[model samples]
Target: MQAVPNAFSVLSHPSLDHSGGGRASSEVPRPATLFESAELLKGGKIVGIMHNGSLYRLQATKLGKLILTK
Candidate 1:
Protein backbone atom coordinates (compact mmCIF):
# COMPACT_ATOMS: atom_id res chain seq x y z
CA MET A 1 0.00 0.00 0.00
CA GLN A 2 1.00 3.60 -0.52
CA ALA A 3 1.35 6.23 2.18
CA VAL A 4 -1.27 8.94 2.53
CA PRO A 5 -0.43 12.60 2.12
CA ASN A 6 -0.51 14.75 5.28
CA ALA A 7 -0.70 11.76 7.59
CA PHE A 8 -0.78 14.16 10.53
CA SER A 9 -3.72 16.21 9.24
CA VAL A 10 -6.25 14.26 11.30
CA LEU A 11 -4.95 15.93 14.44
CA SER A 12 -6.26 19.28 13.18
CA HIS A 13 -9.44 18.21 11.40
CA PRO A 14 -12.50 20.19 12.57
CA SER A 15 -14.82 17.20 12.30
CA LEU A 16 -13.29 15.62 15.37
CA ASP A 17 -14.94 17.26 18.35
CA HIS A 18 -12.37 16.60 20.99
CA SER A 19 -12.61 18.46 24.31
CA GLY A 20 -9.29 20.22 23.77
CA GLY A 21 -10.62 21.99 20.64
CA GLY A 22 -7.30 22.59 18.88
CA ARG A 23 -5.34 24.13 21.72
CA ALA A 24 -2.11 22.58 20.43
CA SER A 25 -2.73 23.35 16.77
CA SER A 26 -0.04 25.97 16.66
CA GLU A 27 3.18 24.97 14.91
CA VAL A 28 5.67 23.15 17.04
CA PRO A 29 9.23 24.38 16.72
CA ARG A 30 11.41 21.91 14.86
CA PRO A 31 14.82 21.88 13.27
CA ALA A 32 14.54 22.01 9.51
CA THR A 33 16.98 20.26 7.23
CA LEU A 34 17.19 20.53 3.45
CA PHE A 35 18.55 17.28 2.06
CA GLU A 36 17.84 15.14 -0.93
CA SER A 37 16.84 11.47 -0.85
CA ALA A 38 20.07 10.55 -2.61
CA GLU A 39 22.16 12.14 0.15
CA LEU A 40 20.81 9.69 2.70
CA LEU A 41 22.83 6.88 1.22
CA LYS A 42 26.24 6.06 2.69
CA GLY A 43 27.13 3.65 -0.10
CA GLY A 44 24.28 1.20 -0.35
CA LYS A 45 20.66 1.94 0.64
CA ILE A 46 21.28 2.99 4.25
CA VAL A 47 21.60 6.20 6.20
CA GLY A 48 21.81 7.51 9.74
CA ILE A 49 19.63 9.92 11.67
CA MET A 50 20.87 11.40 14.90
CA HIS A 51 18.47 12.72 17.56
CA ASN A 52 18.94 13.40 21.25
CA GLY A 53 22.32 11.66 21.33
CA SER A 54 20.71 8.52 19.93
CA LEU A 55 21.40 7.03 16.54
CA TYR A 56 18.73 5.82 14.17
CA ARG A 57 19.11 3.68 11.11
CA LEU A 58 17.17 4.32 7.91
CA GLN A 59 17.34 1.70 5.26
CA ALA A 60 15.72 0.82 1.99
CA THR A 61 13.92 -2.47 2.21
CA LYS A 62 14.18 -5.22 -0.35
CA LEU A 63 10.65 -4.36 -1.44
CA GLY A 64 11.80 -0.87 -2.44
CA LYS A 65 10.54 0.73 0.78
CA LEU A 66 12.17 2.68 3.57
CA ILE A 67 12.30 1.60 7.21
CA LEU A 68 13.72 3.35 10.26
CA THR A 69 15.13 1.67 13.33
CA LYS A 70 16.81 2.61 16.57
Candidate 2:
Protein backbone atom coordinates (compact mmCIF):
# COMPACT_ATOMS: atom_id res chain seq x y z
CA MET A 1 0.00 0.00 0.00
CA GLN A 2 1.10 3.54 -0.62
CA ALA A 3 1.58 6.09 2.11
CA VAL A 4 -0.77 9.06 2.31
CA PRO A 5 0.68 12.42 3.12
CA ASN A 6 -1.64 14.76 5.06
CA ALA A 7 -4.74 12.66 5.38
CA PHE A 8 -6.72 15.86 5.71
CA SER A 9 -5.37 17.38 2.56
CA VAL A 10 -7.97 18.31 -0.02
CA LEU A 11 -7.87 17.42 -3.68
CA SER A 12 -10.21 18.08 -6.56
CA HIS A 13 -12.00 15.72 -8.92
CA PRO A 14 -14.37 16.10 -11.79
CA SER A 15 -18.00 16.63 -10.90
CA LEU A 16 -21.04 15.89 -13.00
CA ASP A 17 -24.33 17.65 -13.79
CA HIS A 18 -23.38 20.97 -12.28
CA SER A 19 -25.12 22.81 -15.15
CA GLY A 20 -27.69 20.05 -15.74
CA GLY A 21 -25.80 18.77 -18.78
CA GLY A 22 -24.98 15.35 -17.33
CA ARG A 23 -21.32 15.99 -17.91
CA ALA A 24 -18.37 16.73 -15.69
CA SER A 25 -18.43 20.53 -15.47
CA SER A 26 -17.20 21.22 -11.98
CA GLU A 27 -14.67 20.14 -9.39
CA VAL A 28 -15.27 18.30 -6.14
CA PRO A 29 -13.04 18.30 -3.10
CA ARG A 30 -11.98 15.08 -1.45
CA PRO A 31 -9.54 13.88 1.12
CA ALA A 32 -6.05 12.98 -0.03
CA THR A 33 -6.02 9.78 1.98
CA LEU A 34 -8.16 7.23 0.25
CA PHE A 35 -7.04 3.87 1.52
CA GLU A 36 -8.33 0.36 0.98
CA SER A 37 -9.42 -1.42 4.14
CA ALA A 38 -7.15 -4.37 3.50
CA GLU A 39 -4.12 -2.11 3.43
CA LEU A 40 -4.86 -0.65 6.83
CA LEU A 41 -5.85 -4.03 8.24
CA LYS A 42 -2.64 -5.52 6.91
CA GLY A 43 -4.07 -8.94 6.07
CA GLY A 44 -5.87 -9.13 9.40
CA LYS A 45 -9.40 -8.38 10.55
CA ILE A 46 -8.47 -5.92 13.24
CA VAL A 47 -5.95 -3.22 13.98
CA GLY A 48 -5.36 -0.63 16.68
CA ILE A 49 -5.43 3.06 15.83
CA MET A 50 -3.84 5.55 18.12
CA HIS A 51 -4.88 9.18 18.35
CA ASN A 52 -4.19 11.87 20.90
CA GLY A 53 -2.76 9.40 23.41
CA SER A 54 -5.83 7.18 23.15
CA LEU A 55 -6.18 3.79 21.55
CA TYR A 56 -9.06 2.87 19.28
CA ARG A 57 -10.29 -0.32 17.71
CA LEU A 58 -10.65 -0.70 13.98
CA GLN A 59 -12.24 -3.99 13.05
CA ALA A 60 -13.65 -5.65 10.01
CA THR A 61 -17.06 -7.17 10.48
CA LYS A 62 -18.15 -10.53 9.16
CA LEU A 63 -20.45 -8.70 6.76
CA GLY A 64 -17.42 -7.07 5.12
CA LYS A 65 -17.71 -3.72 6.82
CA LEU A 66 -15.55 -1.71 9.17
CA ILE A 67 -16.22 -0.45 12.67
CA LEU A 68 -14.08 1.98 14.63
CA THR A 69 -14.52 2.56 18.35
CA LYS A 70 -12.73 4.20 21.21
Give the C-alpha miss distance for residue 45 in model 2, angstroms. 0.5
Q: Which consecutive 10 residues in model 2 have the weakest lDDT in total?
A: 8-17
Taking all chains together, each candidate's TM-score versus the true structure is 0.47, 0.56
Question: lDDT at 34 for candidate 1?
Answer: 39
lDDT of 1 by residue, 1-70 (tens): 2344554465345554354673543555233333445557756888889999999999988787888999
lDDT (Cα atoms) of all candidates against the true structure: 0.64, 0.72
Predicted model with the maximum TM-score:
2
Q: Which ten residues in a row have the lowest lDDT in candidate 1?
A: 28-37
Model 2 agreement with the true structure over 25-53: per-residue lDDT tens digits? 34654445578789899999999999999
Clashing pairs in 1: none
Name the regions of candidate 1 deviating beyond 4 angstroms. 1-35
Predicted structure with the largest lDDT when compared to the true one: 2
